[model samples]
Target: MSDIGLFEAIYSTRSMRRLKPDPIPREVLDQIITAGVHAPSGSNFQNWGFVIVEAADDKRFIRDQYLKYYREMERLGSIPRMADIPPDRRRLFEAAIHLAEHMDEVPVIMLACTGTDFPTYADANNPRSITATLHASIYPAVQNILLAARALGVGATLTTLHYFFEEELKQRLHIPTDKEIAGLIPMGYPHGRFGPTTRGPASDVTHWGRWGEVGQEV
Candidate 1:
């Protein structure tokens, strides 16, 4: 394991988009993928796949599509201006813009996908919506990937903007029609430092037995 302790990793594993062009070690990549597969799944059905992309040609294709949609979103006023976000998040927004511009240069990209149609256990209006549970089978694995990457001192960030062209992405990558891409994770050495994330104190967000109870800090 890395010198970084588990709690430290959790606190310092910021979503890092400003990454160096250095390649991640093959062994390290294998470790991260192994970590992801170990994550628990509903009913022990690990219906997830991780598609790793490193070929220059593939990255170029994905990057072009990402830029096309990002630019269109920005022009349509869908992507908020950095100045409009809170001060604490301005840096993150700036980093996102930078990533969008240089995405093709990143050493590796991983696409997390589900292998089947979303499982439905209830009507759309059910208090616990089926849509919410649909991701329960895969998101734990995605979180495992992020945490594992950080443990290896690899910089990474989760993105879904590519979903704007999901069908196109599948066609370009030859991803099976039954699979749904859940997230895109770009990984490399960080050009910037890893640090604690900013957020409201735990006490402010935690509750007791009831909602809005605002109990003591966790």
Candidate 2:
């Protein structure tokens, strides 16, 4: 297969909420997991772990794990704060619930874990910059996985609601408690096709130096 550029990858990927019931091959899934390890890590610590769940029993458990949050939210009634968001975002959250409600049907689930928490080295409190940087490292890996899967005709959706019950998840999956669960991405073959996507122009958000300052040409 030909090499895929970053732009092509970005354009090719969508949330892919809907997926085929067919199973993903182990070898092909391995390639995606390996791709995640290539991502940059904070201070070159390289402490990330990618967990892929494909077994029906395991996927069902993971799906149940995802439902915990929505159930948690439902018990509390309405969203926790953030009412200021437009209707679209509220709907997006609901859509995520819809997806999670049926997550057992998705063929694969990937959990990105940090393996261990960052060590503190200062007074009462220093910036948790290292942890945030570690998070930044994982997203690129997730991006590559999504892109690679798209190129192979597999659909993927990166999710995070399960993070709400990280400890419970760790216990169920036997993941280390020290590890920070970054995100959960569910992937499988698409029942639909992918093509071009519409988005805001680069000029809309590109800033030269300052937040409000735009480049002369843009």
Candidate 3:
């Protein structure tokens, strides 16, 4: 129940990876999920599932798995080295590493999952057949959760690193076989401050009537 305006929340809500270990109140967590559930879904299916993880043992297991897979990916050259990252984006890279190193310290980890029954027209031969529409159904709710966390002064970031070890995670958490995890968000009080985020102007990427056209027509 923050008095902050919606646009203000939207503009200032950066992905906060450096979070404190201090526990968030249950009511605040409830509000965040409530906001998530209020988001729209395709065909009004609203077939989303959220798993809020707070147990220390569970967090530790997830953290270990994340680090293990992260290092493997790095070894395979899937992730760029520190020297390879652009100077302007290195901070984000560093922050992500920091989170991976200390993910267990984060207070709450929310798993955003989607039921598999949503209809799709993707070709069966395509590897990414279900990905596009499946994400379309769940990511809005994830965005809502992030915005709600920001308004409530909780730090959070959407991550999909868990996807690497998703099957094990589902087994450990007892998630249904028919659902797929879309995003994993770690939430807590921030170790840093929330501020305005930098981004290119919409007009820079916006096109009207056709591609490569900038600016709007009156």
Candidate 4:
């Protein structure tokens, strides 16, 4: 709503793992939460909830949960299932293992959740209209937090692997089984310099109208 230099913010955000370990102040955490809750929701259902954790023990617990899942994936031979995946793809996932091992080193973690049950996904009266608006709503808030962090010299990345083992995560976090954990954002000051990123031009995916109904617009 502020139209506060969004292009720069969007272009600057990237997944940053290394952090400076300086704690995020409570006031800024409040602002990030406020920004996320302000995200558009379907019919004002306002189902988004964010849990912010900075305590050392809690952070370690979450990181261990990640390792539990990662080990399970490795045991199940999920890595080889990516036989079709290029080496670059494999490296990224392997990096996830490294991040999990180091997750506790970050200064803060924000968990974005929706107050909806898994069964609701199959419910005929499911608030598809409501939930659909949620990601769009919360993500901008996430972006706002990330950009604000960058501008403040903090580093962060929003990731979602925890949701893959939602049951274990719920048991560990004591969150009810109903809520949908959308993502986990880890934040802190950068331990190293932020690097330049590469991306394709917008024209590759942008369409003037009637998506993919190409060759008809200027």
TM-score, one value per model:
0.90, 0.82, 0.92, 0.76
Better of 2 and 4 by TM-score: 2
- TM-score-wise, the better of 1 and 4 is 1
Error of 1 at 190 (Å): 0.7
Itemize residue pairs with steric clashes in candidate 3.
none
- Candidate that would win on lDDT: 3
Tens digit per residue, CA lDDT, model 4, 118-198? 233445675764467556556766776777766556678888778767776667677776677888888887766553546
Clashes of each: 0, 0, 0, 1
Give candidate 4's error at residue 218 in angstroms.
9.2
TM match of model 1 to true structure: 0.90
Off by over 4 Å in 2: 1-5, 71-97, 119-124, 215-218
Model 1 has a clash total of 0
Candidate 2 per-residue lDDT, tens place, 6-79, comes to: 78878978777677778999888988777777777666667778888778888887778778777777668655
Tens digit per residue, CA lDDT, model 3, 6-64 = 99999999989999999999999999999999998877788899999999999999999
Model 3 vs truth, CA RMSD: 2.3
Candidate 2 accuracy as lDDT: 0.75
**Which candidate order results from sorting by lDDT in descending order?**
3, 1, 2, 4
| Candidate 3, position 10, lDDT | 95
Taking all chains together, the TM-score of candidate 3 against the true structure is: 0.92
* TM-score attained by model 2: 0.82
lDDT of 3: 0.89
